[model samples]
Target: MASNMGIQIGNAWFQRKINLRPQHRGVHLVTEEILRQVPELLQFSVGLCHIQILHTSASLALNESWDPDVRDDMEMMLNKIIPEDMPYRHSCEGPDDMPAHVKACFLGSSLSIPITDGKLALGTWQGVWLCEHRNNAGSRRRGFILIAKMASPRNQSRRPFTVCIEGNIGSGKTTFLNNFKQFNNTMVLQEPVELWRNVEGMNLLDLMYKDPGRYACLFQSYVQLTMLQLHTMKSPLPYKIMERSVYSARCFIENMKRTNVLKEVEATVLEKWYDWCINHALIETDLIVYLRTTPDIVYKRMRARARQEENLVSLEYLEQVHQIHEDWLYHRTLFDVPAPVIILDADQSMEEMFVQFEKCKTRIFERCRQSERESRLLTSPVSSPKIGAASE
Candidate 1:
């Protein structure tokens, strides 16, 4: 397993070692074979995917999952990494040697991907590309090593998948998710906005007055159910888009924990789910859209939305949510939340905001696909027990 300190193996769900002649392009051929054999590797829950090109003139890229347009775009993008017109000293072997290394470095020497449900943890539009950046025409052996292990069905299925969107309550999660549902192949896993549904036989006024503790538990259940709901859905039905994911669960849990309302069992389950989501969630498309807004703007937007939940949402509550969003962003940036983040000023015009969203479409869709693959791999039924969090 330890081939070398820096040199490690790729995850087995999808891996390959192939001999390639120079001037080879078009999906690297061997990647298809590797992907074809992925179902067998899905048995393993944890592993690293290592890929090394023996030749200096080739590199690997993962931008062409199932679309030719994306592939073309990526190819065009690579052309800029090392310009053909740029001066180079290492042209003795070929014009591409130095540039190839430059290009490879630009792409990456290796990538570590998670394995779940018998598939590679790549997005739908993401694919393994062996960028043959050289002009030499000799056979070069490329190596790909996959390291992975099998996990039990219980661990895999029970693992929760969360997608968190941090913004003030009026920060357009509902609108974004609704629009996201139209073109996104992913599922719409909605956050439980109705606190009333969380508690049995308790009115909002009661929650405001008597047992805020009960309200917290009910809300936590709703949060847990929201996370669990993503896994419960039979996929092949488009990956899911959870309006608020486990991170939000953490946000709420912290509130309850501070209030001493979290029970032992609840704490255990919440911890388990949180750990699983952080580790195995394959959260590439998991975005944190920060709708930066002032308190007045937040209140105005909340009022405009006119939802029942917003009725009791006082200025103090809105301020708290705003503070949480700020805290979430700070921690997210510090720890590197597992996805690309898009920040849109709340004041931006709808047309401008949409244009910005369009600019990020390629990255977003690819992340979605990657997240889906990860979810499948983690949730797929397995026959044996496994150790470590889903992330590990």
Candidate 2:
């Protein structure tokens, strides 16, 4: 079943979600929307862009852009072909709802485009279209997950590559780091929870979880300070694997502020500090590997692990934290993220997690190895030979 297809390949990958507001039943140009969202696309000299709309009721398409009639014709054709009036088993939602799903299946929810000279290799007449199939009752927010692969620059091969681990509590971040530790030339820096707990043997982490209002400000200050320290710490090895980063601190603090755990004055002060630290370049990250799992799953794992700080933690608190992370990480317009994210579904067992590691290991090492080589070349400094000097 193998076809003799030969082509040059790229090793680096980037992925993120692009959000969009609701639109009426029609085809709308979304190429510019995507371009504006993912500025990283400009970094690639040559690559491929794959966009998958993560919903079943809408779809993606590529067609004429200059003519307005094309969109109207597309809608007209779809409506005619899959008439909403047709009787169906799943019509309890609405007349349009069932037809929307049918049209989505026919049109497809994914699109692929080539990248040339850091631009989508689209034709003059062709452009990406978001075909919203639903009739407007209120609003329908939609999103497309974009994954791009590009050739890594040779110069970056020698820089210190850093990877930040992100996940809900009890989503196996520590365990993942432990397994990652076995790799040579890797520096694994764990979360500062232990330090937060043992500061003067008072256990600020436990106090904050048990009684947030009493110790919210104080705990947040120590958490930010320690996380900033971890962020600024230099890694001698090529692979700098960190358990958590300043971004996690932002999510937790934002949750406290949102839930009224931190008062107005306290929220303002702590958020100002966070903005200052981030603006001053306190940390840098090459990539973020998100250990994605549901809040319910994490709660189960947390209860099973029975960590002291987590012993008194309620399911409600865990749900808030999960929502905060979803907002901060995916909804970047609300709160910007420093690096690109790769979401690994962590709902599976430990053995499956290792398999996931193998999948990502190649790209992780590519980034790290590039840095090591670049460092050696820059530091070793070789002189060029003069013309005809060897003969002389």
Worst 10 residues of 1 by lDDT: 1-10
Using lDDT, give the best candidate's number: 2
Q: Show the lowest summed lDDT stretch of 10 residues, model 2.
A: 1-10
lDDT of 1 by residue, 78-196 (tens): 77655776778767766656777787777775555556543457776666766666665344533444444333221233222224455666776666666565652444545544323
Model 1, which residues run further than 4 Å from truth?
1-164, 194-211, 237-239, 256-287, 330-336, 366-392
Q: Please, what is the whole-model Cα lDDT of each candidate in the order they appear?
A: 0.54, 0.77
**Alpha carbon lDDT of residue 330, candidate 2?**
60
Error of 2 at 283 (Å): 0.8
Over 238-301, each residue of candidate 2 has an lDDT whose tens digit, in order, gives: 6778888888888888888788899999989998999899889648888988888788998999
